[model samples]
Every structure is written in structure tokens, then in C-alpha cells.
Target chain A: MRLLIFLARRLGYSIFVLLGLSILVFLIARVMPGDPARMAMGPRAPEWVVERFRTEMHLDKPLYVQYYYWLRDALQGKFGLSIYTRRDVSQDIGEFFPATMELALFAGIIMGVFGIVLGVVSARYANSWIDNSVRVITYMGVVTPAYVFAILFLLLFGYVLNLLPTTGRLSPGVPAPPTRTGLVTLDSLLAGNFTAFFDALKHLIMPGIALALGGLSQEARITRASITENLQRDFIALERSQAIPERVIMSKYLLKLSLIPTVSILGLDFASLLGNAFLVEMIFNWPGMSRYGIHAMLTKDLNAIVAVIMIFGVIFITVNIIVDLVVSWLDPRIRLGAERAK
Target chain B: MAEALLEIRELHIGFEVYGGTLKVLNGVDLMVREGEKVGLVGETGCGKTTTAKSTLRILPMPPARISRGEILFRGADILKMGPKEIRRVQGQGISMIFQDPTAALNPVFTIGEQLMDAIRYSNSQEALGRREIRARAIQALKDVALPDPERILECYPIQLSGGMRQRVCIAMAIATEAELLIADEPTTSLDVTIQAQVLRLLGNLVQEKEASTILITHSLGIVREWTDRVYVMYAGGMVEAAKTREIFARPLHPYTQLLMRAVPKLTGEGIAEGIPGRIPDYLNPPPGCRFHPRCPYAMPICAQERPPFFPRGEDHQVACFLYKG
Candidate 1:
């Protein structure tokens, strides 16, 4: 009962936070020099064309009017039309958002599992060759720029090795079949077209691996450090003296204790995965939010840009709230007094 | 004797330091009866804890090496037991409460979860169903005299006071009714009032369970109040052993006498005079008797050769050159 209330309170706070952040980001993106009216007008457009464009985009309205109108329309699921594509902003997001979400989900799983396993193994064999080797790899992953790694992966896997697809979500010749679920991989599998599913998997491999690589190292290092510290604690020693099986100690005690910090980091990493996907999308020419967002920015599509930013904001805030709830659950001490009071 | 519940024979625990093998426990021998309360007393660095860890086979590996020892629990050498056998014995035959209660319970776990885990570890089959486990947990909490066991079950360790946490630890230790309970300075971390409460609680629980306990502490006062028998360790060796009252009333070894004098009494007017000189460095202890350098009645022979246990009275032994002849 208390948990439900706590979650409800957190979710309410997150919505307000995301709403506020979206407004701020919308204003900042607008203030960045380029006039959406002029950008939409193009080089050969006349004064009247620019004026017609401003009226159509609602740029002629006051700043406060524009924000209020945008917020109201956004609530109603009308994000307005994209000035660049001359299409509804919602349509653009609907078309591309799921692909980004699927990629992020896959990367999150890979990073979370691999990172925790490596961390446990490294901590268990601390100061040994295995520990040193993991540390070295983690350092490399953290220090190397994401774009550099992405380009390197593209060169090695996409260009030179030719083992994976270089561009798009599926093969060029394949007609993208029917979109039942919007997610290429799942929809392909649902269609029972193994060949199409395989092609989608190949296309997904490079980008997912590139994004996961950065997070995996950090997660592994954090888990290793946390577990190592936990291992030195008195409770761990007491547990050992109790003659609990090593497996029980690792899985039940150490892993559970270590996971408190790991879970929080994983939540933040999942959110960051969305941000990182932009670069990955660009490198692979993947038709996802990053590509759409870039086009919106270049063409000064105010409604599309605001809509995309708001969606990202919502995702980030929602993830953070989930992380907070998970942390509280994992560590009962946090809610002890509160439950008693209730 | 029908067979001691726990027997440590010629146990030698040491660690490999940069210099050489630093012996922590040198040929230490002790035994506990099935339901006896044994007080293992020593100053810091006297290897009392190392001896306790050796019995549980929980000593850190590599640097901490048990050079020679046979830790017999119910006539079986625990050191020779495999991992699985050892685990079965742990929490079933022997359980331990550590010095710091805050550090002893996992911070992430609630007092209830930790207690449940310990209970499950001891009797997993019986603790199978959640309802049964919850009932047992409540009973365990009640046994420790915790208020509102139901509410406390939902509370984390951090929310509880130090005294409450220690009680939770004690409750978990006794939950299984293990044959032996090793409490290493369990009350040292609490305040005087709480310490007394914990000490009394431990005594009551030990009696209730009819279990033997190895209470390791440096305070002779605790020895007088809690233990049935006392073993005084000086510089990695047992200097004296006797019934608690007898040892306190007529301490034979100089080290034991000095330790007894060091205990501050509320009835006394003057400040307590602590023993002089620090514990000898274990890296390269003095030859002969490790205590010879500090012994007031040190003889030439005492400085050259270690003294063996000399019989003093019924169930009394002293290791000192003065008692040798």
C-alpha cells in the first residue's frame, strides 16, 4: 500500500519535471539564431511567402501564446505540421520512435547483463590477471569517444568485414513487408519470415553493439567497484563465517547488495541510450528519431522539434522514476520508517 | 569426558607478511563442553578472533594460513570437511554474532529479510512456504523482545537503533538453535545500558537454547559476568585458563593479573592502572616467552624458552616460568 503511494507520488513529480524541462528545451532550441520562418521560406521565397509561412507555423503569435498553444495542442496529441516535410509531426514520430525504442531496449539488456557478469567476475578475482584485463577494457570503452568507436565499428563490420548490413533497418531488395507492430525485428518475426527477421537482426547488430559497448564497460566497472567494496564489509565476512555456500553468498548477499547502485546506474544508462542512439543512427543511416530530429532541426520544424524533445523528456523522466522505485524496493531500509508511520 | 562439543588442538594460525610468517596463534589449545560458556579474553592483536575464525574455517585465504590445527566439532575435523559438508555444519552446528551490528547486517536488507535468510539457511525445507517463514520470523523477533514484530519485519536495518539491530542479530543467531554460538565482542559496539541488555539477553538465549558459546572480548568484567570459564591469551598464546571466578579471584599468570587490575571498577576510588607496554610485534616475537620482556618477575630462563601449561588446581592451568617448577 505504501509502495503504491510512493510510486504514485514519484510519477506525479516526474510528469511535472518533464513538462518543465520540455518547455525550457523548446524555448532554448527556438532561441538558437535561425528563424524557422526564413528556414521554411527557402532562398527563392518572397516576403509574402515568409509571412504566409510564419502564419501557418504560428510564429507571428506572441512567445507566451506560442508556448501555450504548443502545450495545449501537444496534450491533445496534435503536435502540428512539420514545416520541412509538410507532414504532421505526430506521423513522423509514430513512424520512427519505436525503432529507436527497440534498439535502446536491446542495447540496455546487453549492457546490463554483460556489465554485471563482468563486474562480478572481475571483483571475485580482484588484483589478478582477469581483473586487470577487464579494467583495461573498461578504461578503453570509457575513454574512447562514442562517435570514434561507432565509425570504427562501421568500418570494420560494415565496410571491410561485410558481415553485417551497412544501411537501413532491412535489406534494400526486401519490401519491408507488413508492419504489424511497428518494430522491424518483432514484426518480421510475427510475419514468420525468417529471412526478413535475419536481415533485420543483421542491420540491428552494428548499431546496438556500438551503443552497448560504451555502457557495458561503465556498468561493469561500477558493478566491480561496488561488489568489491561489499565484499570487504563485515556482513559479508559474517555471512562467510556462517558457512553459507559460495554460490549463495555471491548470488544472495553480494549480488543483491551490489545491485543497489547498479540498478540506479542502469536506469540512467537506459535513458542515455536514447541520446547515444542519435550518433548511431547517423553512422548507419538508420531511419529513427535521430535522423528525423536532425531533419527537423535543419529545416527549423518547430512543432516536430518540440514534439521529439518532449517525447525524449517524457522517456527520461519515466525511466528515472522507475529507477527510484526499484532502488527503494531493493533496499528496504529506505522505506522502513515510512511504512511504520503509515 | 564424553567428547567435547568443540576441540582445538595445537592450533597455529599465521599470516605471510613482507618480512616473514607472522604467527598469530601459536600452538593454542582449547575445548568447550556441549553447553559451556567459554570466555576467550585477550588484548588487541592477541589472536583471539583468529582462533574463532579458524574454528569456523572463515579465515581469509592466502595471507591468513592455518599452519597446523585440528578443529574438531562433534569428533569430526572441520578443516578436512568439504565445502558442502562445512556449509551444512555452519548455521546448524555453529552460528556467530559479530562486534558491529550495523556492519554485520546487510544494509540493503530489512531486519526481517536478513533474519528470514538466516532462518532459511538453517532450515530451508521447513521455511519453504512464505506464511510459515513469516510466522517463524515473528516468533524470532518476539523472542528477542522486539516491539511490534510485524511492523519491524517491514523495517530496514538502518531504521532500527543500534540496540535493536544487535537484538535482531542475536535473534537470527539463536533462531536456528545452533549448538555453538561465537559472539566476538558483540556488546562492545553498544552503549553501557544497551551493552548490559545485550549481554543479559545473550546469556538468557544461550541458556534457552542449551548451546555452548565462545564470547571473545578483552574486558575482564564481561568474563566475570557472562562466562563460565575464562581463557586469558597473551601475545598469541594462552597464558592461563580456569573457571571464571577462580581465574578472577586468584589470577596465576602475570599477564592475567595485569589484565584483571586493568578492569575499572565503579566501587573503586582511584583510576584503574592499565598494564604497561604494548603487545609484542608478532612479525618477530621475542624468543622463549613472548611476555618475558614485560614480565615483572622475568627470569633469565623465561627470556630464553617458552613456558608450557603447568597444572595449578582442578580445571586450572597457567603458562609462566614462575609456575613451571
Candidate 2:
């Protein structure tokens, strides 16, 4: 009962924070010295066209009035028409959001599973050759920026190696697979054409690996440090003295204790992946929301930008809230304090 | 007439320190019969805890080298057992209660979860279901005299007070019905009153279970009150071993005498003088008798040759040149 109440309260607070973040991003984007209507019309357009465009885009209204109207429309799921595409912002988001989500999900899995395993192996063999090798690889991953890695992967895997398709979500000749749940990978599998599914997986490999490169190294390093610290603790020694199975000690005790901090940090890493996906999307032309957001920004599509930023902000906050609840659930020490505060 | 429950024959534990190998326990011999309560008393840095850890085969590996030791449990050498066999003995044949309960239990798990895990580890093949396991857990809690076992089962280690946590630790250690229990300074972290209660509780449990116990502690008073036999250790070596009354009544080793003098009396002026000087560094411990430097009556031979155990009376053994044949 108390856990339910606590989760509800946390969810309520998260929504409020997300709303504030949205407003801040929205106002900042508007206040930037750019006339969306003029940008849309171009320098050669007539004055009347620009004026009419401004009014239609709600740019002629007072700042507060524009915010209030936008908030009301957004609450009703009506993100006003995009200045560039002249389509509903909701429609644009609905089309591209799942693509971005698919990339993020696959990248997150890569980062989480492989990153943690490498970390544990490295920590368990600290100062050994294996530990040194993992350190070198992790260092290389950390130092090389994601875009640089993405470009390198593109060149190596696409042009030089010819192992994967150079660009896009699928091969050009293949028909866009049925969109049952909107994720290309899932949709391709659901459509049951093994050929298209493999093509999609092949295309996803480079971008997903590019997205995961930096975050995976960081996650692995963090897990290693946390697990090492846990190993030094007296309880761990006591557990060993109790003659608990090594597998149980590693999997049940050490891994469970180490995951609290790792999971929390991974949540933030996941949110950052969304931000990083923009560059990955541009490089690969993946047709995700990041590509849409960048196109919207360049064209000064105010409604499109606001809608994209708001969705991203909501996702970031929701992931953090979920991470917090999971950490509390896995470790009673955190939950007891939370319960007491309630 | 019955064989000893645990026998340590010429036990030698050493560690590879920076300069060279440092011997922590040198040819220490001791025995505990079934159902006997033995107290191993020593100052800090002595091999008392090392001896206990060796008996359970739980000493830290690599640097901690048990160069020579035959730890026989029911005439079976524990050191010869495989990891699985050794583990089976741990928490089943002989369990241990650590000095600090707070540091012993995992902070992440509920008290009940930890208890059940330990219980289940010791007895998984019994096919006890979750409900049955929980009932057994509650019974274990009740045995430790913890109030509101159900509430405690739901609470984490941080929720319970220090004394209550110690009780929980003791309850878990005793739940498996091990043949021998090695409690290493189990009440050192508790307050005086709580310490007394825990001590009393331990004594009663030992009696009820009819199990042998090796209580590793520094307090001679605890030894006097709770144990049947006491082994006094100084400078990583056993100085004396005897029936508890005999050791307290007539301490043969000078170190033992000093330790007895250090104990604060409850009824008297209570001004007790603690043994002066710190324990010798183990890396370069003295050659002959390790305690000779601290012993007031150190003879020339005491610095030259290690003294072997000499019989003083029935069930009494002292390692000092003064009593040596």
C-alpha cells in the first residue's frame, strides 16, 4: 500500500518537473532570434505571405498567450501544424518516434548486458592481463567520440568491408515492412519475411554499435568500480566465510548489490542515447525523430521542435523515475528510508 | 573416553609478508570434546581468531598459508576435504558468529530473506515449501526471543537495532544445528547489558543444543562465566589451557596472570591495570617464546628456546619455562 502511494507521488512530481522542463525548452527555442515565418518563406518571399504565415503559426500572439494555447493543444494531443511540412506535429512524431525508440532499445540492451559482463570480468581479474585488455578497449571507446566512431564504423563495415548496407533502415529494393507495432525490427519479424528481418538487423548493427560505444564503456567501468568496492566490504568476506557457492556469491549477492548504482546510471545513459541518436540518425539517414528534430530546427518549425523536445523530456523523466523505483525495490535500505519519509 | 569433537595437532599458520614468511600460529595444539564450551581468550593480534578461522577453513587465501596443521573433526581431517565437502561442513557441521553483526549481514536483503537463504542452503533437499520455510524462520526468530518476528522478517538490517541485529545473526548461526559453533567476539559490539543478555542467551543455547562451542574473546570475565575450558593466547601463541576454574584460580603463564589482572572487577575499586606495550609485530616476531619480551620473569632460555606445553594439574596445560619439566 505504501509502495503504491510512494510511486504515485513520485510519478506526480516527475510529471511536474517534465512540464517545467518543457516550458523552459519551449520558451528558450522561441526566444532565439529567428523568424520562423520569414525562414519558412525564404528571403525572396513577399511581405504579405510572411505576415499571414506568422499569424497562422501563432507567432503574432503574446508569448504567454502562445504558451497557454500550445499547452492546451498539446494536452489534447493536437500539436499544431509544422511550419516546414504543414503537417500535424503529432503525426510527424508518431511516424518517427518508434524508429528512434527501436534504436535506443537495441543500443540499451547492448550497453547493459555486454557492458556489465565485461565490467564484472575486469573487476574480478583486476590488475591481470584480462583487466588491462578491458581497460584499453574501454579507454579507446571512451576517448573516441560517437560520431567519429559512427563514421569509422560506416567506412569499415560499409565501404571497405562491404559487410553491411551503407545507409537507411533497410535495403532500398525491399518494400517497407508492415508496421504492426511501429518498431522496424519487431515489425519485420512480425511480418515473418526472414529476408527483410535479416536486412533490417544488418542495417541496425552499425548505428546501434555506434550509439552504444561510448555508453557501454562508461557503464562497464562504473560496474567494475562498484563491484570492486562491494568486494572489499566485510559482508562479502563474511559471505565467503559462510562457504556460499561462488556462483551464488557472484550472481545473487555481488551482482545484485553492484547493479543498484549501475542501473541508476544506465537510466541516464539511456536518456542520453536519445540525444546521441540524433547524430547517428543523421549519419545513417535512419528516418528517426532525431532526423525530424534536426530538420525542424534548421527550418525553424516551432511546433515540431517543441513537440520533439517535450517528448524527449517526458521520456527522460519517466526513465529516471522508473530507475529510482527499481533501485528502491532491489535494495530495501533505500525503500525503508523512503517509506519512513512518507 | 569419547574422541575429541575437534583436535588441532601441531597447527602452523603463516603468511607471506613483504620481507619474508611470518608465522602466526606455531605448533599450537588444542582440543574440544563434544558438548564442551571452550573459550579461546587473547589480546589483539594473537592467533586466537586465526585458529578459529583455520578450524573452519575460512582463512583468507594466498598470503594466509596454513603451512602445517591437522584440524580433525571426529577424527576426520577437515583440510583434506574438497570445497563442496568443506562447504557442507560450514553452517552445518560447524557455523560461526562474527564479532560485528552489522557488518556480517547483507544490507540489501530483508532479515528474513537472509535467514531463509542460510536455512535453505543448509537444508534444501528437505523439500520445505515457502510457507514451511517462513514458519521455520519465525520459529528461529522466536528462539532468539525477538519480539514481532513477522514484522522483523519484513524489515531490513538497517531497521533493527544493534542488539536485535546480533540476535538475528545468532539466530541464523544456530538455526542449522551445527555440531560445533565458533563465535568470534560475538558480543564485542554490544552494550554491557545487551552483551550480558547475549552471553546468557548463547550459554543457554549451547546447553539446550548440547553442542560444543569455541568462544573467541578477549574478556577473561566472559571466559570465566560462559566456558568450561579456556585457552589463553598471547603473541600469536597459546600461553595456557585448562578447565576454566583452574586457569582463573592459578594462572601459570605470566601473560595469563597479567591478562587476569587486567580484568575490571565488578565489586572492588575496579582500578585495573591493562597489560603494557603493544603486541609484537608478526613480520619479525621474537625467535623463542614470543611473549618473553613482555614476560617479567623472562629467563635466558626463554629468549633462546620455545617452551612446550607442561602438565600442571588434571586438565591443565601451561607453556612456560617456569613449569617446564
Candidate 3:
């Protein structure tokens, strides 16, 4: 019941956050040095055709008025039309967003699992060869960009070795599974097409790893530092004194305490992956929304730009809320809002 | 005489650090007879806590090394015990209550979870159910004179008061029904009024259980009030060991005598003189007696070699060159 109240309060605050985000993105898109109406009709189109496009889009109205229309249409699930695609902005996003979601989901799993495992291993064997190797790997992973990893992986796995699919969500000959979640791998399983599922999975491997590496390394570093510090805590010493099995101590006691910080930042890391996916999607030719978003920005597709940015904003906010819930579930102090002991 | 429930013979502990190996405990010896309350008294950094932790083998291994020692519990040598055997002894044969209650109890775990963890792990022989373990946990809390054991079980450690946390720690340590308990300055972090209450509760619990205790403290008054025999330590070495009454009546070691003089007397006039000079740096401690530099009665031989325990009277020993004569 208390958790419900807490969540409700958070949700209430999220509305304000989205509202603030919409206003900022709306103004920024309007102020960018381009006329969406002229761009939509092309440079050769008559001036009157561009005027009609401007009036239709409400681009001639005051900035706030334009935002009010955009918001009203947005709330009603209409995001106007993309100037570049010449289709409804919502439809373009609906078609493309799922591809990005699928990649992010796969990458998230990779990051969450490998990051924590490597971290625990590093901390357990701290100062040894295993720890040294993990430290070096994580350092490189953190410093290097996702695109750099993506390019290297593409070159190594695609051209040099011919071991994995380099482009698209599936092989050219393999038909896509019926769209259930728009994630080809999951959709393939849902459709019970084992061949397509394996093919989709194979294609997912390189890009998923590339997208996950930075966040995974970051998580590993955090988990390693947190666990190493927690190992020195008096409670851990007390736990040992009580003869708690080292395995039980590490898993139940140490892991739980160390995961608090790691889990809290996880949402942001996952959200940031969506931002990083733009280049990765382009490189892989994965047909994700981020690639579409990049094209929209280049051509000044104002409606599509606003819609994409808003969706990303919504995703970021929603992820944070989920992370907050998970953290509260893990820590009683946050769950109960109890006073900390001196 | 009762059989020694725990014995530390010529124990030496060191910490390998950035500068050098810190020789923390140098050839220290101690013994706790069955059902006896032994007090290991020393100022801060004097290896009293290290000694207690070593008995349980709880000290971090890489940093801390028991260079040479035999921690024997009942007839078996603890240092020689395998991981399985040492674990069996810890929390079952011997348990410890740390000085700071807050740091001792994990902040994240509920009181019930932590207490039950001790109860379950210590009694791994019996496959006790959750309900049975919980009942025992509630009983343990009640034994400590805590109000609402049920509610407290559900509460995080941060929810309890300093005294209450210490009581809970004591309850957790004793809940295992271990034959021996090591309380390392258990009341130091508590309030003065709460300190007495906690100490009294601890005393009562230890007495009721018929469990032996090794109470490590810097407060001479605590030793004078509670222990049967007291050991005084300076710079990682034992300086004096005697019955509590004998040590207060006739302290043989110059360090022990000066330590007693340093304690404020309730009836005596004016301020008591504190022992001058801090404990020596362990990285390069003084040769011979670590206390010779601080001892007023320092002799040429006192700085030449470390003194061994010399008998002063029946069951009384003082480590000093002066005691040799």
C-alpha cells in the first residue's frame, strides 16, 4: 500500500517531467535553421505550395500555439505527418520503434548479466590475474564508444571471418516472423519458426554485444567497486564470524548490498543505449526508429522529430520509474522511508 | 581448576601493508577457563580486538596474517583446523559481539533475518523450519529485554536504538547457544546510561547461559567490575595478568601500575595522571619491551630483550624486568 502511494507520487511527477520535455524539444525543433514546409515540398516547388504546407502544419503560428497543437494531437495519438516520409509520424515511429526496442532489450540482458558476473568475479579475486584482466577489459570498454565496437565487430565477424550476419535483423532469404512484438527474434519464437529464430539471433549477436559493451563495462566497474568496498564492511566480518558459508555470504549478504547502487543507475544506462543505438542501427541496417530519427533530423521532419524525441523521453521516464520500484523492493529504508540510524 | 575452554599460546599477528608488515600482536598468550569471564584489557590499537577476531579466524587473510599462534578451543587447535572445522567452531563453539553495534549488524537486513541467519547457520545439524527458527529468534530478543520482539524482527537495524542494537547483537551472538562469547568493548558505542544497562544485560545473559566470555575493553573499571582475571596489554604484548582483585591491589608491571593510576578515582582528590606517550608505531616497534619507552622504571635490560611472564604470586604473572628481581 505504501509502495502504491510512492509509485503514484512518482507517476504524478513524471507527467510534469514529460510536459517540460515536450516544451523544450518543441521549441528547439522550431528554432533549428530550416523551414520544414519548404523542405517537405523540395527547393523546386512553388512558394504557394510551401505556404499551404506551413499553414497546414501550424508552423506560422506562435511557438507556444504550435506546441499546444502538437501536444493536443500527441495526447490523442496523432503526431501529424513526417515531412520526409510523407506519412503519419506516429505510423513511421510505430513501424520503426519496435526494432530499436528489440536491440535495446537484447543488449540490456547482455549488460545486466555479464556486467554483474564480471564485477563479482573481479571483486572475489581482487588484485589477482583474473581481477587485473577484468579491470583492463572494463577500462577499455568504458573509454571506447559503441560505434567503434560496432565497426570493429562488423569488420571482424562480417567481412574478415564471415561468421555472423552483418546487416539487417534477418538474412535476406529468411522471411520475417509474424509481427507479435516487432522484435524479430521474439516474434520468431512466438511464431514457432525455429529457423528464422536462430537466424534472427545470429544477426542480433554482434550489434547486441557492441551496444552493450560500454554499459556492461560501466556496470562491472560499479559492481566491482561496490562489492570490494562492501567486503571491508564490519557486517561482512561479523557474517564471517558467525560462520556463514562464503558462498552464501557473497550471494545473499554482499550481492544485495552492492547491487543497490548498480541497480539504481541501470535504468539510465539502458535508456542511454537507445541514444547510442542510432549509429549502431545505421551500421547494421537494422531499420530501427533511431535511424529513422536521424533521417528526420537531417531533413527537418519536425513532426517526426518531435514524436521520436517525445517517445524517447517517455521511455526514459518509464525506465526510471521501474528502476525506482526495483530499488525500493531491494532496500527497506527506501521502501519504508525510515530514519537512518546514527 | 576448570578446563580451559579457549587458549591463545604465543600468538603473533601482523598486517602486510604498503609501508611494511605491521607487527600487531607479538607473542601474546591468553586463556579463558570454562564458564569464566576473562577480561582482555588494553588501550586502542593494542591487539585486543585482533586477538579475539583471530580466535574465530574472522580477520581478512591477505592483509592480516597469524604469523605464529595456536588458538586452541577445547583440545583442538583452531589455527590448524580446516575450513569446515573452523566454521563449525565459529558461532557454534564460540561467538563474538563487536564494539560498534551499528557497524556489526548489517544495515540492509531486518533484525529477524540477521538473528535467524545466526540461528540457522550455527545449528545446521537440525533442519529447523522457518517457524521454529523465527520462534527462537523472538525468544532470543525477549532474552535481551527488548520490547516487541515480533515488530523488531521485521525492523531494519537502523530502526533500533544504540543500546537496543547492542542488545540485539548480544542476543544474536548468544542465540547460537555457543559455549563461549567474545564481547569486544560491547558498550563503548552506547550512551553512558545505556552502557550500564547493556553491560548488565550482557552479564546476566552470560551468567544464565553458563557460557565463558572474553570481554575485551580499554576501561579498567569494566574489568574491575565484571571479570575474574584481567590481562593488561601494551603495544601488542601482554604486560600483566592476574585475578581482578590482585591486579587492582598490587600491580607488578610498571605499565599496569601507571595504567591504573591513569584511571580517575571516585573518592581520590584532584585529577589522575594519565600515562604519557602513545603506543609505538607497529611498522617499526621498539625492540625488547614495547612499553620500556613509556615506562618510568625503564632499565637498560628492559630495552635489550622482551620479558617473559614471571610469576608474582599464585595465578598472577607480570612481564617486566623489575618483576624478575
Ranking by DockQ: 3, 1, 2
lDDT of 3 at B117: 91
* Per-residue lDDT over A108-166 for candidate 1, one digit per residue giving the tens place of the 0 to 100 score: 88888999899889999998999999999998987775677779988998789988888
Pairs that clash in candidate 3:
none
Return the top candidate by lDDT. 3
Q: Arrange candidates by TM-score, descending.
A: 3, 2, 1
Q: What is the DockQ of candidate 1?
A: 0.58
Every model's DockQ:
0.58, 0.44, 0.75
TM-scores of all candidate predictions against the true structure: 0.90, 0.91, 0.97
Reference-based lDDT, each prediction: 0.85, 0.85, 0.91
Ranking by lDDT: 3, 2, 1
Task: For candidate 1, write residues B226-301 as lDDT tens digits.
Answer: 8989999988889899999899889999998888788778999789988787788888888888998888889999
Residues B1-325, model 3: lDDT tens digits: 9999898899999999998999999999888999999999888989998998898998999899988979899989999999888888985999999999999988788999899998888875666899998999999999999999999999998778899999999999989999999999999999999989999999999999999999999898899999999999888989899999999999888988888898888999999998889889999999999998988889999899999999988999999989896
Predicted complex 1: CAPRI docking category: medium
Tens digits of per-residue lDDT, candidate 3, A1-342, equal 766777788889999998998888888888999888888899999999999989988989998889889888888999998878889988898899998998999999999899999999999899999999999999999999999999999999999999999998999899989998888988999999999999999989999999999999999999999999989988999999998889989999989989998899899899878889999999999989977898888898888888899999988988899998888778877766632321
User: What is the TM-score (0 to 1) of candidate 2?
Assistant: 0.91
Error of 2 at B59 (Å): 2.6
Question: Could you give the interface RMSD of each candidate, to one decimal?
Answer: 1.9, 2.0, 1.0
